[model samples]
Target: MTTNMTTKTLYLLCSAAPPVFDVAHVVEDAQARGWDVCLGLTPTAAHWLSGSLDGLAALTGHAVRWQYKLPGEPDVWPPADALLFAPATFNSVNAWALGLTDRFVVGVAAEAIGKGTPVVAMPCTNSAIAAHPQFDQSLAVLRTAGVELLYGESGFTPGPAGLDTPPHFPWQLALDAVDRHPTAQA
Candidate 1:
């Protein structure tokens, strides 16, 4: 049932944000930190990285899963000890909070809450979307449901809407948060 029993499994779920472009580095970092990393992407993210999908799968030594498996089909990746949802877009965050499973990554994240899987999410969005009242409400819902959300000053700080250079995403912060989670410690 486990991929590498000695190594903790981390389901690195990513949405289609600019940060997603640098995910290969993040995977390497996670591997160096002793995690058995399994990369999962949102549909659009999968499309964005279509050309490099093979390389990513080879990097993680696991299938890059973006779509749900058919009924009666076996799961591809190992069960997660913890999950890190990084560069989560506004839509992904809200969808996850509301239990919308249309996207594979969001579905897994939403289900992880009830499965008692430790989850750390760092949402990537512009200041314009961050200002939405619904986004705040969605954040509250996720927090109340025991999801470790990294937003505002704690993690990803959204810059102005049209900044030529968006604020650098703090991948290390999210990784550190995952390390601090109970499941990861176990």
Candidate 2:
């Protein structure tokens, strides 16, 4: 169990979906295992969360990115080791899979994927959207692009599941996936 894994840099992209609490739990767990976590919240998501960016920064010790604003001048772009999009809204998922980078999360994901960085997307949207033909196609595209889509315990949970805080299992599972991958080693 004494592997020399380099410190992981995790970029968490949050959407307005209700499952964001689950995403928070994942971030906290990732931090516990020495991963540096940075959060990028969609404007809609920030409005829905009802918390200040400062609060998030204090909690994670990293600045919260609310827009696609680059880190320059007053900001510094953090080098990401990996990217995770938990509770990804159907809209965001489709946009990301289809190469639409109008949003910060999608933009970052595109960049990371281009750089061969590991990407895991945990999409949480309505069942209808998840079942839509377009959604299926989008997932196929992401898979072909080397993005690991975790369809949750099943094939993606839909609708608001009341954010029953994800038990530590998901975080452990994510880390384990990273460890098992040869490229994840420093």
Candidate 3:
């Protein structure tokens, strides 16, 4: 299949969260807006989608990347005009803010911020996890680095327990954050 060079490239980073399974919503939404979507998954997220890799690859028209490519292998995806990570977990958020590049998802997020790429991380966690002092510090660090985080009202908020699914995942808010980013306007 031929890729349209003119289409805006969006890297949708998927981490382990309940909404991870519903990624098709975000992917389809980005596609509807004329974005050429590239998916980067955390190892756990990759496992979650393990059974459906083919369908997801066909959906994005690109490989589902979960690991760093070897030095000799050419990158299949283009430089991202925007990066959006949804269902970002507590560990992933803190790791990214702390400059930990051990995982593919956090690595890309940290490097993207350094490259001045527009990035948005919508974390999915309960209040129990949000109450962690380190989490607040992590969010501050990420915000200081120009990483737009979707939280609070109109964004992602910690939901109560006893529910099989999170009440909402704020996928559109992440998309909106990307849309509002000055560099992403292209």
Best by TM-score: 1
Listed per model in order, the count of residue pairs whose N, CA or C atoms clash below 3 Å is: 0, 0, 0
lDDT of each: 0.89, 0.69, 0.85
Once fitted onto the true fold, the runs of candidate 1 whose alpha carbons sit more than 4 angstroms away are 1-6
Better of 2 and 3 by TM-score: 3
Across residues 17-101, which tens digit of lDDT does each residue of candidate 2 receive?
6566555566667776666778887778877665656666766667677676655655444687777776677788899888888
TM-score of 2: 0.80
Native-vs-model 3 lDDT?
0.85
lDDT of 3 by residue, 1-186 (tens): 225754688899988888999887778888877678889999999998999778888888999899999889998998999999888888999899888899987898889998999988898888887899999999999989988888878579897655556887878778878888776765
Which has the higher lDDT value, candidate number 2 or candidate number 3? 3
TM-scores for all candidates?
A: 0.95, 0.80, 0.94
Candidate 1, lDDT over the whole model: 0.89
Q: Which is better, 1 or 2, measured by TM-score?
A: 1
Q: Which stretches of candidate 2 lie over 4 Å from their true place?
A: 1-6, 70-75, 152-155, 159-179
Q: What is the alpha-carbon lDDT for the whole of candidate 2?
A: 0.69
- The window of 10 residues in a row where model 2 has the poorest summed lDDT is 160-169
lDDT of 1 by residue, 54-146 (tens): 999988999999999999999988799999999899999999988889889999998888899999999999999889999999999999999
